[model samples]
Target: MSAVPAGSPVRTGAVVPVLASAGITVALMQTLVIPVIPELPRLLNASAGATAWAITATLLAAAVATPIMGRLGDMYGKRRMLLISIGLLVAGSIVAALSSSLVPLIVGRALQGFAAGVIPLGISIMRDELPSDRLGTATAQMSASLGVGGALGLPAAALLAENISWHALFWVSAGLGVIILGLVLRFVPESSVRSGGRFDVLGGVGLSFGLISLLLAISQGADWGWTSAPTLGLFAVAVVTILAWGWWERRTSEPLVDLRTTARPQVLLTNLASMVFGFAMFAMSLVVPQLLQMPKATGFGLGQSMLASGLVMGPSGLVMLLTAPLSAKISAARGPKATLMLGAIVVAAGYGVGSILMGSVWEIVLVSLLIGAGIGLAYGAMPALIMSAVPVSETAAANSFNTLMRSIGTSVSSAVAGVILANLTINLGTHTLPSQTGFRTVLIIGAAAALVALAIAACIPTRSPTPTPPATPASAEAPATA
Candidate 1:
């Protein structure tokens, strides 16, 4: 592999936008079915628990495939893997659009999940192609696309669900996928850098099993009875499998994850903080919409429709988009560590304010904007932090692993929030709803998570960690100068 010639043109102007659009498209899939989740059981003629698999399948598949696809992106070609990912998204959307029942929908969703690598891969591509000065903001925007798409997609999805068949949602997803795929092919360039190596088939299998078992336990624990044999058994299997996987990863010459690189204090602490930030970030998503849509009769409920709630939440994503560049500027001047800390502090403050000011729609909107800004800032800094500490060859895999940590955190937050809300419910006439106390408690916990992330970010070294030697590429000699 060789670098592009010094005089060769790089169409960076086109690359960043295309990659970012690719990222936003993949993210839309995550929220595409959210508006239809409650109606799923009736629509699909399946039990509620069975229909829930529509969501779980995507989670499990994303968790399992993100890292593996990322590794392939590094080894083969980032652009190549990215195209394959979008292709899967298109295929999944079409399959889902055609499905009238549970099984195919779940399968389609799992395939959509396989595209979760797109964002990290896009970040990696930006690193490989963008000018150094352009890299931070480009990656920041790409990172924020997750929230941007989720926030923006909700109202559109709600509208579609209200006026159009639910299947229309998948059709739209497929249509967008096709457009993004064409744009990527036309504008994005395959990187010359490659970490050529045989795929770690065994490690991938082990990690997949471990993640699936762990997430299944966490996601289903409440319904399964937290202490039930199935939940405990899955937890046990997860712990053992992850431990064995770690052992094997440490020993394998060509590993699925380079543990040595991952264990560096900078990388380790960033991942820990990412998980905590993820918990804090998701806490808002869980609390706000419910607060907005709750019946006004409960004394606290706002009684808004799903579309109204989504519209109210829409500005938060806009704030995130607007804040991404500022985050990059902060990272440039003060360091990514400072940006991360600032973001955490803002998040904590947002939740703290949310706890006190839950009385009106305006107050909730303010809270959403504050937290969205915080998440944008934090998310922008993460790739810089990871890239600074990792070898160029390992960029996608390392970033993918960080993304996985965040996903894990959100999963745990969802489970914990569900338990808190389920156990602390108030009866409104004939309906049971999460009590104001439960929502308050979740907000408090969200603030606590932000504070924890802040503390963890504080522990990160003031200086970048000394990077380990770049791994030997299986197909080519090491670069003469790095």
Candidate 2:
């Protein structure tokens, strides 16, 4: 593949589409079950709390698996790890398709989530393979794939669940995975750029435990009660574990994450912006659906069905698809930092306008579209910014860490939004639902988070000229290549 030379379009364009498709497949898993969540208990003969594990399992698995797989890709071949991730998705989907009980379903779901490393892996592959001129557009599209798959998947899953056996959902997911796997094998080239290392076994275990504890507490704290012992205990353990992990990473010869490079202001600030942007993007997703489906009798609600609400939000994904290339263009001319700041402002404006426009379905749809466009712009810039600062050998690990930050942001948004909607509700006779004020509060929070990202983006110094020297393999077992 390196035969295409540095600027060859054929070499650059050939890999991006398949890699992006793989990315979309990974993101689709996040929303595949949303339409069936309410019916899970009745369908599986389980309690609501027990059924909730299907979602939680995926979240936990993704948080732990993303960075680990990224590190593995750096040590191994990027294409090899990418294919492995896709294989896990297919296997998990097939297992879920065959399951009737909650245990098997949760197990399969977690397995599916284990494939969450694909997005970062794809981004890293692009960095290694694509020409610098093509890199921005290609990476941006890869980043937008996360939202595109999610937005498109919701309505598709809803339609499938409503029209056919719910098992069809998993089967279809499996089919998509298989198709993607084949496409990846046929078109995507294996990246030669390797950041080979002695995989830090203890550090990996510590980081995984730390992430699980922290994310679990954040995700479940609202359900378990914020002040509960289990929640507090998990939070405390997470802090200590994470601190220890950092200490170990700093000392280890072949660290899982390059703490020194990550400490640079550019990478640090870019990751910070990604987290806040993730938070801001999720706010629209959480609020718009609730606002649309709530009864119009509540005066603020649009009273749409779940399917209708999904349809209303589906167009946003298309907006993201269209905006990604434009974002890349802006980044090429003005720098990714400028693009990121622009995206932040646009997102903040989306929320500000959306708060006032909640009276109609079109208005809400417009808001989702606006937010999606901003997300596309910001998301596209992130990989470009990260790849610019990190070494070729550490590309996958750095990208994976950025993806993890986004996940952290989304998890916090879910917990925070859940709390606001829960407490700030209106009682209507025998029924209680989140008040319009609660929805407004969440939108405002989204705007504030975007503005915070904007400020952080401003702090990222304009793109630097410093270059990473080629690697002398990380260890005796590692490859000696870029």
Q: Which candidate is the best by lDDT?
A: 1
Work out the TM-score per prediction: 0.95, 0.94
Off by over 4 Å in 2: 1-11, 464-482
User: In candidate 1, what are the lDDT values of residues 397-439, reduced to their tens digit?
Assistant: 9899999999999999999999999999999898999999999
Query: Which residue ranges in model 1 land beyond 4 Å of their true spot?
Result: 1-8, 464-482
| lDDT of model 1, residue 473 | 36
| Whole-model Cα lDDT of every candidate shown, in order | 0.88, 0.88
**How much does candidate 2 score in TM-score?**
0.94
